[model samples]
Target: MIFKYRKGDELIEQTVVKPYDSVFGGQFDSWNVGKKLSNLTTCSNFFVDIISPSSPDDAPPLATLHFPVYTDQNAHCHVDYLRQFFKIADFCTSGDACKEKIWSTSYPDPKSDIFVGYDEDTQTLI
Candidate 1:
């Protein structure tokens, strides 16, 4: 299926290899895999592309690291890990600019502790 979140953005047509599945993510999801029955998962081929930080957005990824995606034993993917991974990238979780660095930059006034170590629950550094 072809999907693109924004207009004027490139469209990505992904073949449904696993037909029915969702990117449930390993962390921050409403569901838990800690259960003995829930822990059961099947392996699927997944990958992340690493690109040079200096490279342009249009540039091809430098390396593709294939990772294992776990699904339920029932041939249905309960969660999508890639979504979880990318969503994490959309925010900041740091303390000191001179200390903590991410792909990692200090944004919006250069580390005024803006979203430092983003505590979503309390929304505070503490």
Candidate 2:
């Protein structure tokens, strides 16, 4: 994916590669060994091109198997939430500076910490 960030008026682009499997039903995608090897070789070559000539250190060894384990549902959920939060943060912080404003008129001050009744069952943030 190409991520574009603005420095003053100029835009800088960065490319990030996310390796994943093609067969998994859930978020943890599986990749074939051959395909993984190919991707690693390509990445190593790219790194070689970018590193300075003085730093002739060879590319770090690549892992043979790529597997991310989410131990529990809560861990998986938190990861998904963080991904969404970053997207929202990017939009909020990009370009011009913006201020936070509360829209609800029902509460005297929506921005202030006012106690609202919570449900014991769900333990939700209200």
Candidate 3:
């Protein structure tokens, strides 16, 4: 998996080969892994890039799962960015939406305090 952070034109990408099981209780799935990455207390511009083995070519990301870690205010800039990238409906959950969807959607763990934005282009959420 590739972990990334972007602001304006500056994009920092990191290739993670080993899993930090001790830090995140060994959760390896995308959602849980994303949750762990989202907990970087000082980070607000975090994103997970799932590299497709079949398509190693550099193309625009078709899907994105945004984890916004704003404690004071539940706001994220990636929503508009993903909207323009995927050309899909914006699905955002915050505060209450976070609490409800986590359980209803069978998320591995609850995400009550974070803001989540899912790409609708891949039709994953539907």
Q: Pick the candidate with the highest TM-score.
A: 3
Q: Is candidate 1 or candidate 3 better by TM-score?
A: 3
TM-score-superior candidate, 2 or 3: 3
Predict model 3's lDDT versus the native. Answer: 0.47
lDDT string for model 2 (95-120, tens) is 23323322323324544554675667
Each candidate structure's TM-score, on Cα atoms with residue i matched to residue i, is 0.24, 0.15, 0.29
| Residue 59 alpha-carbon offset, candidate 2, angstroms | 12
Can you tell me which runs of candidate 3 are displaced by over 4 Å? 17-46, 71-126
4-90, model 3: which lDDT tens digit per residue?
444223554444435556865763543343544344434355455655444556765545555444432333544544554466433
Scanning candidate 3 in windows of ten residues, the lowest lDDT window is 67-76
lDDT of each: 0.42, 0.33, 0.47
Once fitted onto the true fold, the runs of candidate 2 whose alpha carbons sit more than 4 angstroms away are 1-34, 37-50, 56-78, 81-87, 90-126
Pick by lDDT: 1 or 2, better one:
1
Q: Considering lDDT, which of the candidate structures 1 and 3 is the better prediction for this target?
A: 3
By descending TM-score, how would the candidates be arranged?
A: 3, 1, 2
lDDT of 1 by residue, 1-126 (tens): 111111123221222122234574332112222452355454344444444556777877666545333545634553465554445534445556524444554533445646557687987763
The 10-residue segment of model 2 with minimum total lDDT is: 41-50
Give lDDT for model 2: 0.33
* Residue 31 CA displacement from its true place in model 3, Å: 13
